[model samples]
Target: MTEKNVLIKSWADPITGACPVAEILRTLGGKHGPRILHCLTEGELHFLELTRAIDGISRKVLTDQLKEFEEQGLILRSPKNDARQRVGYSLTAKGDALCGVFGQLYDWSQYYR
Candidate 1:
């Protein structure tokens, strides 16, 4: 089928194309992203704080997840004014918009337990 046809078929209710947020969800649904978002939900946090808050996450994984989230415009990273070595991450408007969806997912998971 043509690309357009495939997309149309994918969007149909039964087999609707991948979830609307598939791209972002696939990347952000990782263990690290939820933890990162939970940390930032309170306030901006530096890399060190995130690592500590998300115990067991490797430095490399944290770095990679942050980079992906930033690139996707889901989060903002700012350099600390007093410390050039310090950077903090916070969710953006787009990221905040997903809060409801995340909450629903969390609630649904409880049903399966």
Candidate 2:
């Protein structure tokens, strides 16, 4: 099969252990997931920064979303390596790939607002 065919087959057959889009969609379908993912578009952010940017989100919800994103291999959460108990979150390569779609959606929202 061609490379493109292989890629499509991989994404289409979740049982083959290659497809992850379904899981990603499920996790990101939650209210906080899209918000958190959107924030990562600009740059890396710490937990506090994310919480502040997406107002009305509770600490528990943010924590859950971060954990889900990490588990989905969409975002990376790493320590600051400083004295402060700081951890930073950034989009992984897979996560970055979704930026185009997210950006389009963001732009489209302007029309509705």
Candidate 3:
């Protein structure tokens, strides 16, 4: 197989193990997963900034999502050195890698659309 074919086939079905696409889809399957990640891609942002950037997302949902992402090792939540003691969210290396996948999917989406 050519390199491109091998790459595509690997995502479709691994040669000797189970494909991880299902798990990836599950992690990304949500109203705000992509949006939240996209926002963080720009740099670390506080909770309020994420809320404002992702239109129509409620506080409760945003909180839940951020919690989930932190648990999954996709985001890092830390106390920022500021007067208000604000918390900031930023993507981990794994999260940044996943963002590339999202970008590929986005390009594929345009082809289909």
lDDT of 3 by residue, 1-113 (tens): 68787665455454657557876678778889889999999999999999999999999989988998999899999998889989999999999998998899899999999
Model 3: per-residue Cα lDDT at residue 9 = 42
Best TM-score goes to which candidate?
3
Candidate 1 deviant stretches above 4 angstroms: 1-19
Q: Candidate 3, which ten residues in sequence have the lowest lDDT sum?
A: 7-16
The total of clashing pairs for model 2 equals: 0
- Backbone clashes, each candidate: 1, 0, 0
The local distance difference test score of each candidate is 0.80, 0.85, 0.89
Which residue pairs clash within candidate 3? none
The per-residue C-alpha lDDT of model 3 at residue 76 equals 98
Runs off by more than 4 Å, candidate 3: 1-19
User: Pairs clashing in candidate 1?
Assistant: 10-17
Residues 15-50, model 2: lDDT tens digits: 677556786677778877887888998889998999
lDDT of 1 by residue, 1-113 (tens): 68788665353235755565566668876877877876787778899989888889999999999999889887899988874579989989877766556778889999887
Instruction: List where candidate 2 sits over 4 angstroms from the true fold.
Output: 1-22, 106-113
TM-score of 2: 0.74
Model 3 lDDT, residue 58, Cα: 93
lDDT of 2 at 113: 86
Q: What is the total number of backbone clashes in candidate 3? A: 0
TM-scores, one per candidate: 0.75, 0.74, 0.80
